[model samples]
Target: MALRKVLQQLENYKSEKPNRVFTMYLNTDLADQDQQGGEWKIHLKNGLNNFEHYLQKDGDSDEKRNFWAVKEKVENYMHEHQKDLKKSVVIFATGEGDIWFSERLQMPVQTAFHWEDQPVLDQLKSLNKQFPKTGIVLTQKEQIKLIDAELGAVNDTTLYELDLNTEDWKQHQGPHHADSNLGSGGVKSSKKDELAERFEENRSRWYKSIAPKIDQYAKNNNWDAIYLVGSSVEVDELERNMNKQVDDKINKNLLDHEEMKIIEEVM
Candidate 1:
């Protein structure tokens, strides 16, 4: 789901009586200086225990029961996704299951926990503003990758490959592995250098041909910003040809890297 829609739903929600919402933002990034010793584990345990202790001391029997139920669900979810956890995890859940939203994000988040009538969304809102909806274009010789992202998570990816036979661009949806020789047609090793030279000669024209396609995609997806990543020649050609304003450019060939790694570097 879109982050905006999720935030709207949380904004509209308000727990009644014994049913309160649980909001958690847990940082699981081991590379973080403060989390080198797995400090987040201790933080999570203490956060949940503090809530339980509070309800036990001041809440009625039904509220206490609701708190316990929510706590169990939260703990089970963390355990199940522990292996796949990314830099951070955010969740908003209710005891009765009216609201259940969980995301393991590639971006870092400050650890927080709350039990209240409404979901605590201040930090999440801040993240949304910081990241927004962005399109990252990774351009190489005969390949172009467009990544649609929001809130430091990939929503979708579109790959455009140059079809040498037809001299046209072919679009493929979702993640794809990079082809070292996209349209090589199994050229002999001896001729590889010649092929590279020819590609360089036509590089600018080829990139310009796809510029309109990228602009149209950005318009259709309502991208807040566009980034170009590749060699100086490749990115410069693409940025010059495209009508949309390029927000930034990175002089690195990241088309073959993992999506999360690309995001981490550029974002």
Candidate 2:
């Protein structure tokens, strides 16, 4: 589900009396300086214990039972997903299973925990605004890659390769592999130079042909912004030809890089 839809649902949810919700945002980024020693584990344990202690001291028996139920489920979820954890994890769940929203995000988040009438969503809302749904267009030579991403995670990717025989763009489902032919030494230098010159001369027309497809894709995906990344000429041509507004452009040929790395560099 889209983050916006989840946020909407969460905004409308409120726990009834005795049924408090559990919300947690944990930062588990291994590369972060403070997380080098796996301190998040200690933090998670202490945080859960604090909540349990508070309920035990002041809350009714029903609330205490609810808290325990939520805690156990939360712990199980954390343990199951720990191996696949990224930079952060956000979860909003209730004891009765009325609401269970969990996500592993690539973006870093401040660790926090809450046991309250409603989900704690201030940080999540801020993240949605900061990292809105984005379309990243990466181009190099005859190859173009379109990345659909939100909150630093890639949701989908489409690769377009120019068919020399047909002089048309052929669409592929994902970022399968880099165009090895671009760097292969099998082709004669003169032929390669000739192809390069031809491509340079027809760059504008070529990009123009694919621009409408990209614009339609952005519209269909409801992208908040579009970023273009490639050589200066390629970026400029693609940006100029596209109907949608280009939010930013990076003059770097990152078509061969991993999707996460591309997100890091552009975002």
Candidate 3:
């Protein structure tokens, strides 16, 4: 995932330079689950406040003591940058009165934090696969749909659809081919073959043409992973013609299905 890549790179820098700071990781959903029932913001605020209070007191726990030293800066950072918090989880690394790392996640984590590496990293690693964002591309000969997938819901407005006039030869069986197969007309057979070839060429070109656009769209939307849903030929053509970076992110291939079902299955 893009977030993991960025975080890992930052972690490497931190390792070499060695900054003394505390990391605040908040899993809003998980925090809310601990509460009887309340808004995400309230749960998040309460969790952080409790931890901050605990850290400020003199304690035998080494982790708590470490957290105490940077409590002021960490609290200020979280308060100032609370708007960055989104669904799932958010990690904010703070020191020097500002956030060093802040990111919203598509996957949830436990609501907790530490002075250094947070437990969230371990959960992400355990998944063994990183998907900062997953997009579903449903394609056919004449139509295509790009859908963004989230934890529990699919954004219907994000569904991008493209329609084309390209026709399917299999569905358009003309008298030309029928008469030719009867051992009657050679010219009709030639025309039939030419038409069939042209149809295939046009269809293949259509798929190829859309590949780059799809790649661009994914990049613009920050989709780190994508699923292809369509006929094998169309999917293969798109994959073959896609930009290398985008092509590498393809995680699944599925036959086109109903929109809701696709979302449910993928999520």
Candidate 4:
């Protein structure tokens, strides 16, 4: 798309939602064609293909062209299932989804990248400051290992940011099995939805992105709700995890509610 067109789209997006957000990530992956820069294309392709099939509403043959209709579809889905879909930004990261972020067509997003070899703590702290509204998303141990140092002179007791696995699973059996008999292909949502529009409109990107760490957190903590602040791709995952038909032994190591709630506090 032309720069002007992209800018126009972004302006529309901003006018429609100045504070609300949908997130994406720029991550690194080892087994990718462009091994460097996290191969964001992979994530973009995932969403595109998934959305293509997802937009098939009522036997429509060429619904993908209706890119403008995507927002309404997604919003309607949330509206209908407002109870389950927490009215928060949709988020996604690498390994599950590719990065297809057009700054001209969207807003600035929180970033998560493991630099080649730098003090992740300082980098993350700087990023935290840059994206103050979104907060920061990092692994449990990573958050603790690095972030704790940022509290230089600051009281350690005030540190309530890390979402670490701070519970004892000794009482439970073992690792829990996740019920993700998730579809690999040919999955569709109502075409009348924004999800449908996204799938239909985006044919050159990936959308299979979801933060497994977040899912694990939810499963490990037995949470009814959780927050993901990365990309709109996360919402698709939230639906997948939340709408599962059956339950599996995802986390056999069941921690006490009180202990698990501590994890939830930061997540």
Candidate 5:
């Protein structure tokens, strides 16, 4: 299921009887010493276990058993979706049988938990509100990048011969060049035009190939908006050629000179 739907379900959850809800945010970046991914499940289990221990001491036996049941449901979920755990995860579980919600996020998030009223949704609301609410597309002759600005997630695809930046098209000098032969100018001029034509063809093909993918990605992920990053000419060409639906989502274009600077500008 999509992340938005899962979050919505949690936001909409309701029950006639009193419901116990626990929300957890896990930081899954193993590189961070304090936020150890390896121990995430362990820590979560410990939290639930500790709470269950207190329930055992004071609450009725049925309530304590129900908490244990909730813990089991959470454990089973983590076990089933081990591979989906990434930079961050938000989980919500209720005391009733097997009701839960979870989503993986690309951005780093603080580890936290809250026991709140029915339909505990503040955490998800805060998470959804964070950041640029933008998707970024970076294009060069050789590659295309689709980035989720809020989540810091990226998807990359190679452009075959589109890496024109590394190629030497200048050697073919355009018709305007002073040095040329009589026969349609020098063989060099013909070569230059041929190279230019090839570049244009490749650029056209690249746009055709990538535009649909970008539209589909945005539609599936439900990005709030999208930005293009590249030269004005390239960005303009893409904007012109892309589908109307895709074009409508373009927030703006950013100069693509430096990667880090572009990220800062978008953020």
Candidate 6:
């Protein structure tokens, strides 16, 4: 079914209770070539001056607002578990940037510009020691795109929700649409071979970024299994390695989407 919007969810949170609220963020932007090196600065808004209301498509990234959205979701989730958040920690993430947005409705405005330095493949060796309880998980495009279907599934009215999500829908309008660098020609298609290569590259980085979080989450929650979502190929590959520990819903949506809507056709 269609989950209500954030405002509606917030209303429910006010009436809920919790034992504890724990929030954490997973990193994803390390794919950029020649990334930085060092610790990160959290709560900086240096790159948000450009957009008023922009969508994440055709190159120009308004992920600053995306970060703000993450904050909104956290507030809503915290409201659901208000009894526990008095001591909860909300985490936001970026690959080279260990920056996380946590100030609730008003994220800390940035006063300086800094680069992210975290390695994409870096993993925290200690699972239980790293994270205890968790809340909002701020994430990268790559990470969210690969989320397990069950987590973002629609048993009934959710189909309507997905339709609404893509109201001014376009084909392939997932994270790739969000990341593509568009020039004057508008959205351009990469050669299929190139697309394949990019998928592999992303899958590699995603695993690197999520491995520790997965292991840590499992150890903390006593969860013997994990669900994964991704492109049919990428998540499929991920399943090969974590067949027992992870459950994948990779690209199942796209495959079921037999009525193709290539951008050229939609336009």
Best by TM-score: 2
Better of 1 and 6 by TM-score: 1
Model 5: ten consecutive residues of lowest lDDT: 168-177
lDDT of 4 by residue, 1-267 (tens): 222232233334421111122233333233334534434435444544454455455344433333224433433443454333211213211211121222111122233322111112333234334322211121121111001111111101111121113221111122222221122122344432643454445312221122333344344433322332222343333335443222211221122123223233333
Task: Report lDDT (Cα) of residue 51, candidate 1.
Answer: 90
lDDT of 1 at 144: 93
lDDT of 4 at 80: 59
Residue 75 error, candidate 5, Å: 2.6
Winning candidate number (lDDT): 2
Report the C-alpha lDDT of model 5 over 51-81, residue by residue, as the tens digit. 7777767757656665666678777877887
Instruction: After superposing candidate 4 on the true structure, give the runs of residues whose Cα lies further than 4 Å from its correct spot.
Output: 1-65, 85-87, 91-255, 258-260, 264-267
Candidate 1, 24-96: lDDT as tens digits: 9999998899987878779889999999898889858888888888888888988898778778989998888
**What's the CA error at residue 12 for candidate 5, in Å?**
1.9
Evaluate residue 74 in candidate 1 and report its C-alpha lDDT on the 0 to 100 scale.
83
Question: In model 6, which runs have C-alpha deviations exceeding 4 angstroms?
Answer: 1-187, 190-195, 201-209, 218-225, 240-244, 247-251, 254-267
Candidate 3 per-residue lDDT, tens place, 16-79, comes to 1123344445564434546325355565566656765765573435555444445554466557
The lDDT values for all models are: 0.88, 0.88, 0.51, 0.28, 0.58, 0.30
Candidate 1 lDDT score at position 1: 45
CA shift at 165, candidate 5, in angstroms?
24
Tell me how far the alpha carbon of residue 223 in candidate 5 is from the true structure, in angstroms, after superposition.
2.6
Q: Give the TM-score of candidate 6.
A: 0.24
Count backbone clashes in candidate 5. Answer: 3
How far is each candidate from the true structure, as Cα RMSD in Å? Answer: 2.6, 2.5, 11.4, 25.5, 10.0, 22.7
* Candidate 4 vs candidate 5, TM-score winner: 5
TM-score of 5: 0.59
Worst 10 residues of 6 by lDDT: 154-163
Q: Predicted candidate 1: what Cα RMSD to the true structure?
A: 2.6
State the lDDT of candidate 2 residue by residue for 200-267, as single tens digits. Answer: 98888888999999999999888998999999988988988999999999999899899999999999
